[model samples]
Target: MRIGQPGRPLDARKDELILQAGRELLLRGGPLALTMEAVARASGVSKATLYRRWPHREALLEALVLREAQPLLSMLEGTPTDDAGLAAKLEAFLDSMLALMGQPGYRAYLQAIVALPQQQADLQRIWWLGPHQTMESVAALLRRYAAAQGRRWPAAARDAETLIGMAIGLEQARILYRQRPWRADARLRRRLIRAVVASFLGRRSAGIAVCEGNVGRG
Candidate 1:
């Protein structure tokens, strides 16, 4: 008989154990240490069961990130009725992302992935795919915010990417590269969020002005 029977209900407890084991292994020893054997041993689950849930290591890692991203994703899924509401939600999302990046284990994992040899397609693939959906959701939020003001921001999706990239870059520069004490005080977080929002709005206004000038010339 199959280890997990066809009709048998899956155990939530076992799934949590497996995920928890995977997370601990990842945080403790990077991706290289998170082999199927290690996870199975750590979680005290049979290899067959682990394989039954996650076919490969990448799949398991992706699941872990997705789980971690749920709260931020939930906020993105919300509807913000006004400029203030959108700005508040965006700030919350950025704060959440910064918090995730601030985690030593998570930061190490991202840095390790980035430092991998160019020949490793997995690194590039993960980097692109890991945050693609969340960025899209963010773009949707930005678009909604602009629409509410009766102004269309061209390249909302690109702007979303830029906002996230800026946050990550700031964290890397201050906390990771400089090895400075990471102080995510409320004031700093607010400043970062404001910078991103202001930059986007500035570019958006400039674009509108340029278009208007061209229309006048025509």
Candidate 2:
């Protein structure tokens, strides 16, 4: 990890070690304890290595959020071959995200990031403007599905943003009240997607329509 070390070999486990160490530190003592030195000691990686990977504490923490969110992003990728498939993927993505936010690790990470102190202007800027990959991914998934159905959801992005916002807000409230973690209501949320589409298109059955449910009951 020395600077100017010619032909230095990279450790394959470096990123994993650093990120895992960062998570442990954050989980153990929140943001205050997640210093570069702490992560280096915990992971047995050099501070230099940590900086090389992420220029500052904010960058490292942001990477951690993105890493944790990978599964939600994965769930929504690619075109679903049919209406039912599309509806299922979208629902699963929504379900997984809400469920994830209720988990201890991911919830704590979000809590730390979302409520970062006012002094952390840089990190706040990065987060507020967003990588928002999951939200963006959901929007993209909706558009593709609409295309497949030979229709347009004019408000897909706006609705997708609202849906994501609500899921996070619900989990934030749960976190605030110290409620036991919970999962998304799979059938109900899928039905919600159908309802959203129908509202915009003005039919009980329209785009990705039943959301492919009859817009159906479970």
Candidate 3:
């Protein structure tokens, strides 16, 4: 019974091995396949070693998903360049998110998390909140961009949610259900990003129009 104590330094290499093994197991056999014994055997680490780091399978999976999502999540907090226009910033954000969700392995991990039983509420919450937080960060960026432009896009944050939902929803569906090779083509990706940005701007314009009409009639 090796208890994980505070200030206990974990071996980076060992941690990587364990996580990698966990991912492989997850991809091969879904969440059900991820057991402490299985991960230990796969990673060549003893079961005690695995337990010391992650007490249960859910803990291991949550950590693995967070580790993978952290890089993209960091980008959500990135400062846009002074000269980068809203469209450019939006394009960059969409590109990063698409790339992250487009990876087959990452998609599999997400699907596994989604498939978890409702009884595992904690794990499910952790899995869902990571992506939800990313979405909120994007909304914040949109609001910031609108402010920078000296324009009040009241719906900027809502539109941001729409943009993220559209991109991720489409890509995830295609990746999970469509039985076809989805190669990344730069041109197509750019087109998609442009369309999403245009949609957001268009929706903002419509919102402004409705507001103006309301004021005129008042």
Candidate 3 regions exceeding 4 Å error are 1-10, 81-85, 106-115, 146-157, 181-183, 202-218
**Cα RMSDs, all models:** 5.2, 7.7, 5.7
**What lDDT would each prediction earn against the true structure?**
0.74, 0.67, 0.70
Best by TM-score: 1
The TM-scores of all predictions, comma-separated, are: 0.77, 0.69, 0.72
Please write out the lDDT profile of model 1 over residues 1-218, one tens digit for every residue: 23355665566667878899988887666666678899999989999989988999788877776776678888887667775677678778888877776665766776666565667755544555457778988999887776777766667889899878876665677655646525356577678777776675567668767865776465
Candidate 3 lDDT over residue span 131-217, tens digit each = 776777777876676566565556655776788776555566677774542425557777877887777667666777787677747
Q: Give the residue spans of candidate 2 off by over 4 A.
A: 1-10, 122-131, 165-169, 184-218
How many angstroms is residue 201 displaced in model 1 relative to the true structure, after the best TM-score fit? 4.3
RMSD of 1: 5.2
Ranking by lDDT: 1, 3, 2
Rank by TM-score, highest first: 1, 3, 2
Residue 13, model 3: Cα distance from true site in angstroms: 1.0
